[model samples]
Target: MTDLKFGGYQGDKSVHTRGGRVLAEALAKETDGALTLAFDESIVSRGHKAADLLSMTESGELDGCYFSSSYLAKRVPELGLFDQHFAVPDRRRAYVLLDGTLGYRLREEVAKATGYEVLGYWDNGLRHITSAVSIKSLADCDGLKLRTLANEDHQRVFRALGFDPQAIDVRDLPEAVKTGRVDAQENPLTNTLNFGIHETHRHILLTRHLLGVALVLFNAERLATLDPDQRAGLQRAVDHATQAQRRFAEGDDAICSTELTAQGVEITELDADTRAAFVAAAKPEVEITRQNFSAELRDLFDKELSAA
Candidate 1:
């Protein structure tokens, strides 16, 4: 039996990490126990940092890893750009993009760009802003150092809105806030709850920044070396994990607003006018990404999403 060393973020055993657990169990069953998974160590703890996890996987030092869009973008720039447009403010449309044409096209682009495969697309739900203060308009971002990940899209969006985006690593966020290195951050409600960010921040601006995230990944030649049956088993495992994680993320996202409120994290709902201002600031970046991708592919994605 071959043991697969799976690594994940230490986010309170949330659905994201638990999804990996499901994958391992599924693979264990499908492989008739030939493949087992063990995960305790994280790529973050190994000096690769969150942004470098996928690159470590490519180097064959790590067997498998789960990453947010920001973390995955370290090695794949175009996919990171996808994080911007993929966030169309509609959770259902975001789901349409993933699982539909958006998922397939972006996966192909990632594979071609990184020389790796996108094993599966899973939901992370939507993202919201956690600030110490309220945000009523785009101007509210001025001079605010918002903590974002290494995601180009996130930085670009904040930049477009005229703010100083502090690209902080996830692990360092708590200290960054305490030290006043950043004023706010954009993260999912699940993350706020799981990572205890809600304890530090007071405002959660509902932006629904993309439908959570779709993981772009592969472990270099590992999957390529698997026999056909092994490959199918592994694929099934990834898919099953995706399904479980999506369900978990969706429910958690719904509960997040209430959960945060209970924790004293004020939920700030942007009115239509203010939301329109944000859309105005962000839409150009989305259109610019259109040229970065193929028109045919983008159009195909639109069709698939519409069909849904």
Candidate 2:
């Protein structure tokens, strides 16, 4: 009978928002009308940023939140393993790795490190580079000042690729691009359009370099207070919501190129050799990540991903 507050930073049209709605609706049905839930889209309205959401959950001001795993990796370095470039090439393989043993183990590790339980991993889709300049080959990236996530793994990969990377908050990225503070940045197509980065950056490459996941996390302590039936119902709601969001993400990827092109953004589909070159440039960072993070989990991730 307790009311649950779920918060998301994504706007109304985003899958993150849709997923939260699905979770709340399913939880209501599964709990047989015993639970009340309130959903807030863009907690930034309350002066809460994405990074602050985790701390808010830990302090019990927020019951749950959804954000990129890389944001969480900032606090728990081991989670950075997922941020490695070209880690999951396609959508199908991404599900294999995340829904399999590797993801379960990593979730446990994350839970121990942070006081949040991973309910599910929602697909953020594959991230591609968007720049003020067209990138037709690997050479085009030279000396580019790219905006990137503040996560070390992301910055390290961009640095290795012969570009200068500046970490900028998503909220500030539009001005960052307009002011020439950064020449380029990377994100999923949906994010580029949603955040209005596509308007400022005309050239978008289909590098498909990184696949990101938005983790739906609930405070472990809060979840533990639910009765067994309620807990099971809540978990099921997350699973169902995740599946729906994944479908939305996949569809968005298919539609984005046409949409961006219509808006005057030049879209380049990377040739196989060009993509391979960027991958090779980024490969060295993987070993560094493994060495610096949880080797056991990274090794298992490699073993499982390779097998698939």
Candidate 3:
């Protein structure tokens, strides 16, 4: 049995469980119960946290996990570089860049640096502003208490945009919003609904602020030890699971739009004028993100993805 341990909020049925379960079941069925899974449920659980899980999987303590890309920013700024401010529109466009240019380079980097194997790619889609108030433009962001991942760049971007960002653990956000400690926050549809944010927010402004991607990684050494047949079986399971991940994320995007609106949330798209201002505010930050990208890799990436 392939032992797999993943991290996510216990109740989260979005990407972590949604995608992880597909792989777990596939492996188990393929191995005829000779494989097993052990999912690690922890919040404050970020992508960088998976490094140890990958190591342990190599050492036989675990198998693999659905690791977040945002959390890796602290250790290797380049990993989180793509998540920098500004919007990428939708998941489809985001994937073209992520799975295209960024995804290829990132996997090579992680494998070389951390001995982790990137199993598959799954982009969770763009983030939106869900709040107690209607936020139509950049001007509306001023003076609002916004919730964000307690990461250096995330807080910096929101503060630069003129919002007073409260760097609290995400588990406390709903309570924080309920108590009026924060008026608005940013998160993707998959996570927002998984966390039940719709119950407390009245509006969800369509601001493709940031996109999230989870990298399913495995311990490199362990993967290498598998016989050719087992390795093929594993890759086959992941290939099938990749399609499941795409389906789950895309389906939930539609579900989130409908569910939140049905629950009385005001869902509106930002007008052209507001969108322009918002893009202007986020441009320099995003440029900085692009500039910080590895110079040599960026050129290769640009050339490779353009071909793809």
Give the per-residue lDDT of model 3 (tens digit) for 1-308: 55655444424566557677778778777666655556665533543332354345546555666656665566555676557666444556566766565777788877776756887776656788888888877778899999887566777677767788887666577678778888888887766776777778788888877777777778787788777777777767776777788888778888888887787878889888887887787777666666656887656545654554
Q: Write the per-residue lDDT of candidate 1 for residues 4-111, one digit (tens) a residue.
A: 766776555577777877888899998898777776445556555565666666776666777776555555554554466334546566666677756776777667
RMSD for each model, in Å, please? 2.3, 1.5, 3.6
Better of 2 and 3 by TM-score: 2
**Model 2 C-alpha lDDT per residue in residues 1-308, reported as the tens digit of each score:** 77888888778778788888888898898888676568887777666665677788777778998888998886677677678787676778878888999889878988878899998999987899999988888888899999998788888888889889998877677789888899999999998888888888999998888888888889889998999998988888899899999998988876876788888899888888988899899999866876767668878877888887
Best by lDDT: 2
Model 1 ranges off by over 4 Å = 45-48, 70-81, 85-89
Model 2 misplacement above 4 A? none
Clashing pairs in 1: 125-212
List lDDT for all candidates, in order: 0.72, 0.84, 0.70
Per-candidate total of colliding backbone pairs: 1, 0, 5
Of candidate 2, the 10-residue stretch with the lowest lDDT total is 44-53
Q: Please give the lDDT score at residue 219 for candidate 2.
A: 87
Ranking by TM-score: 2, 1, 3
Candidate 3, 4: how far from true, in Å? 3.1
